[model samples]
Target chain A: MTKKKQPEPAETGATEHQLWEVFTQPGGGKPFEHAGSVHAPDAEMALQNARDVYARRGEAVNLWVVPSSAIVASTPEDIGPFFDPGNDKPYRHPQFYKVPRGIKV
Target chain B: MLGHRLSEWCGHGPILEEDIALTNIALDLVGEANLLLGRAATAENAGRDADALAFLRDVREYRNALIVELPKGDFGFTVARQFLFSVYALHQWEALSTSADDDLAGIAAKALKETRYHVRHSAEWLVRLGDGTDESHGRVQDALDELWRFTGELFLTDDVEQALVKQKLAVDSSSLFDAWKRDVTDVISRATLRMPGDVYMQRGGRSGMHTEHLGVMLAEMQVLPRTYPGAKW
Candidate 1:
């Protein structure tokens, strides 16, 4: 098990401040999409940074910022087993099914 | 002039995010100035447009406060100035949003939204800088102290504005002081900085009197237009 990384104390003057992963919503009840990352001392600053960095030019109607350390990403070593595809299953694809004329995707 | 000062941070901010943030603010201010200038031109009833008024103005003719005309000292200074000015501007806009005049009210209503965001951004920076480290705290506190005197000018109601205020055409600048002070005190206390008390307030920017810096800035800002009148791309 990977150890959960702790965020640094903001006022201690860390060399590299905490990294925040940015997600932005494009409005109209759309899901938030990963935009980019920004460096900030804490959550409030992270949100402001995300607004300045990612929300310009009408790119976002909403923004979300998460500490990069809080995210647990899979390693390349686990690629084979974690997302293994034992065989091609053509029937599992939604496109394989034929629908009546009145049906819509 | 504040917009001009903010524009200096276009490529010179400490971080990429700040660079964009400052420049975005600069653009917003400049746009606001453009609209205000257009409104002024119509009010003047002269044949001048916004460009004419901006490019043709002399040093003493420009009625902007001294704080904005001062050079962009440092990031701390810029943030401090933004906080002070944005707060005042926000209140002014809020009051003016309901003015009897349709044009001024419409402009103020739109500007209120932008000013609100500007206040939020600057206030956030003020807290971070004032509480972050010993060096940052010292610098930002110094900035706040230096900017404190200039804030009085924001509440000064000139004769023209007072007359307009009577007719409900302009906001009563003096009336906004208490609310502005309360908000400023709250933010300063939260930032853990002492608010400088009762310094000699600077004044006289509204009557066409300004600092020496405005001339140099105007020279730079108006050179092209002055040289080639009616020149266009």
Candidate 2:
């Protein structure tokens, strides 16, 4: 609640319209993936616009709409400290475990 | 026919994003037309293929609603026409999804989801235009009044629809009117726009009677196909 409204970059060439990021899940059990973004004034319109722009080809069975302003994003400068810790921890990966000789693996 | 009408606004929407959006909708409708006409070609048992049915049909043979055949007036007019038509289409498709004909039911099931988005898109625009500034409100109000007469044709049924409905292969369009009215009234009220008065509505699209606009549109649409009969890329 205390977070400031995030400023959207003008990369979409729609500086005036409110930006909404669209995420779509292709089918049941499928992970939601970033589809695209749309410009709309409100959430309802955003969802509709997202459907028009993203899911026209039956590409999605589920959709999620988030206002660009409400999103909390990390900057490029945060890559080193914010992400590197996870990268160096090999034991955290499932592939790190060695298979026993008797097991199918 | 709807694709052609919508395609007229291809590069002419109020904004770039909206322009592409309208074109995308046009393409979607064209895709549906392809499916329906393909079915009609075989269902009619005529020697004609889908292309022939589409490109060779006279204006009198068209089964589309008059509302879709009407000329595009302005942004307000386009939005109003689309809002009304989309609502009708949503209901029609919803009912058709359960059709006894598997092909039609499959098509309708797919189309229902698309029309759902179309309804939301057009309904949102109607509200925006109707509740906008004084100029916008006036423009959309005038559009609604002008377009209202053609809407009756959407609910008009004929022998063809009756036969199909009896077979559970088509939706009963007449039954959809009450729900359509209620829904339209609700949307209009949300937009702070008044519903048009009960007046004698223009009709006759079901049986192929149409305004001159369809002829002009047909002429343009059929030109390329007619000119090069067997040409394909």
Candidate 3:
């Protein structure tokens, strides 16, 4: 089995700082959405950096930082087959049904 | 006053990310100054508006901390000074948030949130710079030592602050010294930095007797207003 990459030491002098993807909740019951990224030594620093970088404008009430390396991403080559099928499946959408009006049901 | 100081770092920060960060911090300070100065204008009730009070004030009439007005030094010095000031400002804002004057309290409440972020940013930089490399450590240490003298001025309470405290409009500045020291020492220890020994503290910013730096800064800051009276944007 292949070995997983390890995080660098969280010391200030550490040479390798990790990149963290920032997610922010805009409040009012909205879900967290991807904001941007910040470079920090650890989770604590990453959260603080995210606040300084992404929430400077009061645009977010909550923030989450995830290691960029931990994200499993699919490339553009997979887009055609991986996500295109949803375009042809319009029947799954609620708008696809035509309700017979006049009755409450 | 703080906005101008922070603006000095606008294009001069060591890196792009930090440049933006410093500018943002400057903007936050400027906003806070606007709120506080607005209150000052209304309280004076001498027919001066915020703009007139801000732009027309003589050098000796200004009341910002001497530390904030000091020239922006090297990156290490800048961050060190910022960290030190933010520590004190955080406590000041915290106390001000509970003031009897609703307007002051409201402004302080908003400023407190921003100041919290400023403290975190500067404190982190202090640790990184203080422990990063030998050269960085030495430079940041020098910054801490040099800026320490100006710190006492932050907690000095003169007649104005005392009056405000009695009126429930302001916190006694001296009361913040212990908490400020605890916070500063904690960060210094974490950064592996040494606290400078107590020295003769600088004074006079509160009483309007400022260093020469304020004179040069005011010349540039007031140039526009003096050059063109009642000019609108």
Candidate 4:
């Protein structure tokens, strides 16, 4: 919900209008998970394309189509600083402390 | 049938996303036909099943509207035909959802959901193509112009539908024209396209009289069933 689309990414080709990242909620109360992607001119078509490409045969009860440009993913340059710092510290994992039963850390 | 015609676009849509989308709608329509024809067979109290009615019968015995039988001319034409038919079908299904016949009402209820999506999908494409660049705009307009004549047959009601209407067993398709027109007019205008004028409206799919194209299509569709008896899909 927080992601906002960035405009005029040069990679968008002549025939391509936009690329959308599809997310699906498997059931009520479930979190939306990244499903796949589709190319459409706008959000309306993106949503429908998600349904057509992913929702056939009752795959999901709900759908969300986010513009791929909206997502801010970590680049390769950030791999060492963003991820490696966490791996050296085992106490960051919940197993180091008393945890509620059935709770996933 | 329109379903078969739509299915032909399975691997041939202009874009990959659209290709999958169009074929999904085609499958929905094909499923609708299977259910409707199965019910028709039961209603007739004849030994014939859906397979026999669909594969064994000649084109002359078909009762579908002429618009569905015409060739899928282009991407624009396909979307235009879907928009035209889905709007009408939505209305018809709405009326049928309250039918006195329980089975038909159930089928209508299920079909109504599918039809809503069909209407949305086609209407979106129509707007995109019609309001698009010169080439897209011109092509869609031409397609719409060519398909306008076939719209009249969709609302035609004969004695079969009339008898069922009186008994609350069928929808009065003729009565649905006004709403269809209103909805279609709004979408066409929104698409930045002019409505085709009242030219000569083609009719007669109800009587099984079709253009020369149907026979050719039927040959391809029915060949397997006609040659290899008792073939199952």
Candidate 5:
């Protein structure tokens, strides 16, 4: 007797690994700025993965890759009301100060 | 000594990608060596700073791993040495990032980023050479076999490590060994290269003993500062 055969599942995209957030410094004098994210198997691989994904065009002088899980981030929705209180502080604005001619702020 | 040996690849590498990678790695190592030697100088109360330790010190006085002092032979050999050392360094830095000594932890935090890249770059090269072709594969395998002996000293426990570990300024070298072995094995497996088995381990870099390659390297590296003494830009 012939039985119905089970079909194999179709192949999917590359397996998703842990996510790592990348930060990069463009040059010696520059501050390290957040770049983007990459997927990798481990920290060592995450570093290389970030290099290929973020620094391909010599855009980085340094790089930092930390597991996304390791980072504690504030959500925009949660912080919006918390940050709005500071917006009413007009005294915090530097525009209130007058500087001499040829002086840069 | 570490800077001198690393600087040998400043302009000479098999490819442009590799040349830049090696030089960048060298620069990072030099930077770390400067920081460490500066701390060592301060600890010794020698009234010497990083420059004095880096430039004025005689060959016999330098304390760096012999693996770092060995010359960059071919691309394969360079990659093999880098692969081993970077894995060891990465583990060291990872552990040191939590060190009770704030300065050491800070240095480890910064240096860890660079060491991570160094490990990846070399591991990639190892895989490439190992899996490329018959000739390339054979050469890389040979390089690994030759360089394997020197790796033992990387984890050799001694007074410095013990003292530093007690002070919480350094990680225990013995603890790092298993992680390092696992990393290298994974890379080797991916590279299709067989790990050299049952080889005699070379020792004596932590105590200032080194291969003959170090002397020539020191001569060139120390020349500018030794000749001028106090010259500055």
Candidate 6:
């Protein structure tokens, strides 16, 4: 199978600093969505950078900026084994439980 | 004046999405103004709540940045104002998020997100209009020229900002000017729009001074409350 393309890292020989991941909640009741990334001098500047980059259309109510360096991401190769055990736990499946008629999932 | 003008679109935007978007930004700005004005009221011992400070106050009592009061000439102008202000606000909120005042910092932390989208939406439109048809380009450029005069007021610092800066409750507004310019210019240039050249800058939004438009806006916005006198929706 063809491998999924990965996001490229920051280019080398660039004078500007690193990128920051910006997550946002559209409103108080919404979950945060990864809006996009921005580059800036530091965490404080990163938040500003992300604000300048992401939240333009009433699409966010909250913002969280984490340095690209601070994040610990799992690679695709690690996903199968790391998540495999839980897949075989049939008891964890909702299908085993009986539901009342007309009940929605 | 701009906030009120934009707020006029509260229930009247062309589409629901645009409606929500415009109102949301208006509320964000009005909310921010409320906070600042409330603080100013307290400092001045004006004995007014935020609503009173916002609705009951006359034009001469408002201290909003002039850029926030200018008429929203058209969608392009509105977007231009939103674009510039959002960039400025994003930087302001980011800095304020770490302010010494916990309340102010917390508010900033929350507001930064809203302001972020305001910037993005405006920027997106700026790109579309700037790089779209010749008519679109021309009007957007016209909007920029008309709006540029008010921008200087955004970065102008006075006693309040100075005192707040000393108290660590505010950012030095001037410090963000370069970033604001770079951010706005980059977007304008990419959109193929010309930035207005050396122009006479309008001042006086921060000293309870205002444009004639504010009186009319306040009249309409405050009429319901003034007429009903405590009637609830």
Assess chain B of each prediction and give its TM-score: 0.97, 0.97, 0.97, 0.98, 0.94, 0.91
TM-score of 6: 0.67
Best by TM-score: 4
Q: Model 6 chain B, poorest ten-residue lDDT window?
A: B12-21
Q: Which stretches of candidate 6 lie over 4 Å from their true place?
A: A1-105, B1-3, B35-46
Q: Tens digits of per-residue lDDT for model 2 on A1-105?
A: 112233344655655678889999999999999987888777887787777678877899999999988889899999999999999899999889998889994
Which residue pairs in model 3 clash with each other? none
TM accuracy, model 2: 0.80
lDDT of 6 by residue, B1-233 (tens): 44567787877764444565677678777777777667666766857776777677778877778787776777788888889888988998998999998878877888897788778777877876787666667778888888899889988888868998998888999999999999999999888888789999898878877888777777888898788876678
Better of 2 and 3 by DockQ: 3
Least lDDT summed over 10 consecutive residues: which range in candidate 2 chain A? Answer: A1-10
Per-model root-mean-square deviation over C-alphas: 5.1, 5.8, 5.5, 5.3, 12.9, 12.8
Please tell me what DockQ candidate 5 reaches.
0.04
Docking class of 3: incorrect
Residue by residue across A1-105, what tens digits does model 5's lDDT show? 112233233443434656889999999989999998877656766677677667867999899999999998778897778788778887688865678899876
Each model's lDDT: 0.87, 0.85, 0.86, 0.89, 0.79, 0.78
lDDT computed for candidate 4: 0.89
After TM-score superposition, what is the CA distance of residue B94 in candidate 4 from its true location, in Å?
0.4
Highest lDDT, which number? 4
DockQ of 4: 0.34
By lDDT, the candidates rank as 4, 1, 3, 2, 5, 6
Clashing pairs in 6: A55-B116, A55-B117, A56-B117, A56-B118, A56-B120, A56-B121, A57-B117, B1-B69, B2-B68, B2-B69
Compare candidates 3 and 5 on DockQ and give the better one: 3
Q: Which candidate has the highest DockQ of all?
A: 4
- Candidate 3 per-residue lDDT over residues A1-105, each given as its tens digit: 112234345645565567899999999689999998888767877887787689877899999999999999999999999999989999988879888888576
What CAPRI class is candidate 6?
incorrect
Off by over 4 Å in 5: A1-105, B1-3
